[model samples]
Target: MVANLDASSKAGSVLIVGAGIGGMGSAQLLAQMGYKVYLLDSAPGIGGSMHLLDRTFPTDSCGICIMSPDQPSYCPTLECGMHPNIEILSYAEVESLEGEAGDFRALVKHRPRYVDIIGCNNCGLCVEVCPVERPDDHEGRLHEVKAIYRPPTRAVPDTYVIDMDYCTRCGKCVEVCPTEAIDLGMAARRSEIEVGAVILSPGYRAFDARIKGEFGYGYYDNVLTSIEFERMVSLTGSTQAHLVRPSDGAAPRRVAFIQCVGSRD
Candidate 1:
């Protein structure tokens, strides 16, 4: 059941899972109306599908301009970093849930950022010093992310995150940062909260392009998925909105669009 969008009663808080567009919209509207809202997400950042895009379709609106710096399109969990009513739980997952419909207790585990999200200034300095670069899923193979970096250009909480999986503990980012926000040995934290209602807004996944082997997907650099093409065409996208062939970095003259590669089977 959809709760009151603007109900301003601290009697029962709303717990929202998945800080996608839907989750953010719900949280925004609810908080605007005076409701005590708790936005939760397993990912380190928010904005979900929107974060990966360089621009929105049809109008080509700048996605970065559409989001608030206070409440980043990325890192929805930290939305409350600026708000007094909202609490953002970043790098955290719900470990346990109990109680009846109106009242529930949720155990959450917040993974370490290694770097302090609050102190880091979101400067690209550390990013430049870090030698390791990884495939940015947001950029669709177009851009590379540093070992310690934000999800995107204007990430919320203006903090740095340690790509724990790839971090070699080189300490270069920590050494170069002017803020000294890098904490190499931070550990995961756990906490619990009570809420009156829970909202589920799990977003849809992009259709995988690999299933259509006929397109020469990974084998052919020229071939790309619709989403990848969209990213290529986006300004905020990894290519910074430059469209080019993956193999030769040359513009394409003849492009083909195949609609139902994985769906409608």
Candidate 2:
């Protein structure tokens, strides 16, 4: 038996707490059902951990090329950005939540990207002028990038973001930018939003292999994490798909894969 519930009585908005594949998928579905979705993420851009991968398991397919129903050429990440019902709130986190299921209030804290998403045209000029260089986290620190850079190749809101930690406030990028989008003094913002429901999809974090000193993750030059190995062989990675030893440019004669390093514990 179906209960004839009044559709007008319930709120029509949803707050999705993560912007990973799972959260993105959920947001797209909800938005299709005539609900407004607020896709919030702590990173400067969306795609989550999956964004760092070269290929997926079993099928060995590109991890970022998620199929979209509306646009065959666009991935879900890009689709979410273009969708009218979905509002991407990147570089933000949920501070608090209150109220009942149908009528909920959330306090969201947003971190400054230090670059205007809509203003910047992603011309790579800022990256060329900026003097500061930092280890690229996306490549497992195997490569270096300018302080101001895109999170990934195909990141949504596809704009440059400043790594405030490494930024020297040199003002070189500011002078060279054609659109005047670089801002070193930008400040964080906070907001309170009302939503009909809350969905928590905070993804998993990679285990720190350094804790297990026996593996020599940090000490040995040849030692590599699963992510590092994946990046090393990735076609778009630092080596351009060439599998070579980190200590030297030579191809490895033999390799060992240790399964269940953190999981077994």
Candidate 3:
């Protein structure tokens, strides 16, 4: 419903600082209550921490599937990112905020997606031809990911993002995309949005396990992070969710975890 906004309008409006489930839920509620909501996140897609787990606790139900529209019991505002009255800006972050409560102004820095979100159809052709492969940061970088790849299958804003750091400028994905969505070069843009209130749901970042050299998080091939282990056992993850050692891709019979790697009294 909020196709455009005026900073001067002090009407009901909100700026949600993250696009995770919490942020999405808050935005949906505020919007349903007659407020213009804008959701933002640094990641290209939503789902946040839930997207990394193999199986949810207590119930083994698939995390992504359970969050779909059919699973209204889970989240009534499923696909909230694309909901009307709510606009989501992914691969973006709030650089600065000015003005007081109920009438705030913000500067959002949007990193280039390389692929146009409006044009992508999720055909997954770009992933097939893109030769650039690197450790997927989504799974805590446990699995391999193409330079141009989509988030989880059910992720909102079902679009692909390019890891420009490892992209070789080969333009293979660009050539293969059916919708011509891939752009090897895209410029970053900034948005100046105004809202009556702000809601922040920026999630926590995984602690770098490499700091504790004694634990061999990166030194030992067999050692893996908790997130990595979760990905290894994830049905949609690398090795087809097989419980295998990263060292030689062999089945692991038993595993041990060391807690509080960086946290100590």
Candidate 4:
């Protein structure tokens, strides 16, 4: 998945390895400074882990909304996609880095999304016709979605991606797509890009609650992870913001929060 960089292409270019808030913000700032910015992320769409949060701490504001007086409705994630100087490489990861401080070559590997992002209009016809269904990982597997599905509500490059693991390759989505955007035979790609600088903003991974078996994260029906709880309370979550027990639909009369279960070790 590695490729040789073209020497002539190296200039005032920057590569930001992650499409979270920090990465997207950096890309926009650099692009404004007249630099060609490449925003790379290993997800179906941008927005990173921020897509999981219902609200931010301290202020308790919506996580996705970037408030600004000039444009109060501005969304940074969506803006990154529209930036002329910025090229978003979603569903991709940097495999290797070469060269020196001033000029560097990055070998990037892109995973196959199957669905064409540009050709697909987010019509959801592919999703409607697809017979395969899987637990929605974005929603903490609390709900189900078709084999081909969109990343999130406000994901940049808003389009559907096929979960090849769950897909039976029945070709129902390709047949029903009005835009003919689906391709089950799509293959992964690799590219080498020249950049003046590289910024790493790979976000944090939530602690796996299953590691501490005492809490019975997967074994017990009532047990839940912090992320699971966050998704449960989210307005876009399974219950549509209503906090309820996973074991049963009824709202729990009592709740408990354990602090630092896998930390301070």
Question: Among these predicted structures, which one has the highest lDDT?
Answer: 2
Q: Judge candidate 2 at residue 263 and give its lDDT.
A: 83
lDDT assessment of candidate 1: 0.72
lDDT of 1 by residue, 1-265 (tens): 3344335443368888887767777787667666777878776766677666666556665554355443435444345445566677767788888876666788888899888877877777888888888877666665678777776544444467878888888888878889888889899999988777788887888776777788788778788888788778876676767788888888888889878788864
**Candidate 4 residue-wise lDDT, 1-265, digit = tens:** 1124332355578899998878887777777767788999998888887788868787787676553112463787877888888999999999999987667899999999998888998888887788888998777656798888889878887788999999999998889989988899999999999887788989878778889998878898778888788888988787888988877878999888887898853
lDDT-based ranking, best first?
Answer: 2, 4, 3, 1
lDDT of 3 by residue, 147-260 (tens): 887876456677888888998998878788788888777999998987877888887777888887888778888988877788778887776678987778789898888877
What number of clashing residue pairs does each candidate have, in the order they appear?
8, 0, 2, 0
**What digit string (tens of lDDT, one per residue) describes model 2 on residues 53-81?**
76777768667664334434367788888
Q: Using TM-score, rank the candidates from best to worst.
A: 2, 4, 1, 3
Mind sharing the TM-score for model 3?
0.86
Q: Give residue 59's error in model 3 in angstroms.
A: 2.1
Which candidate number maximizes TM-score?
2
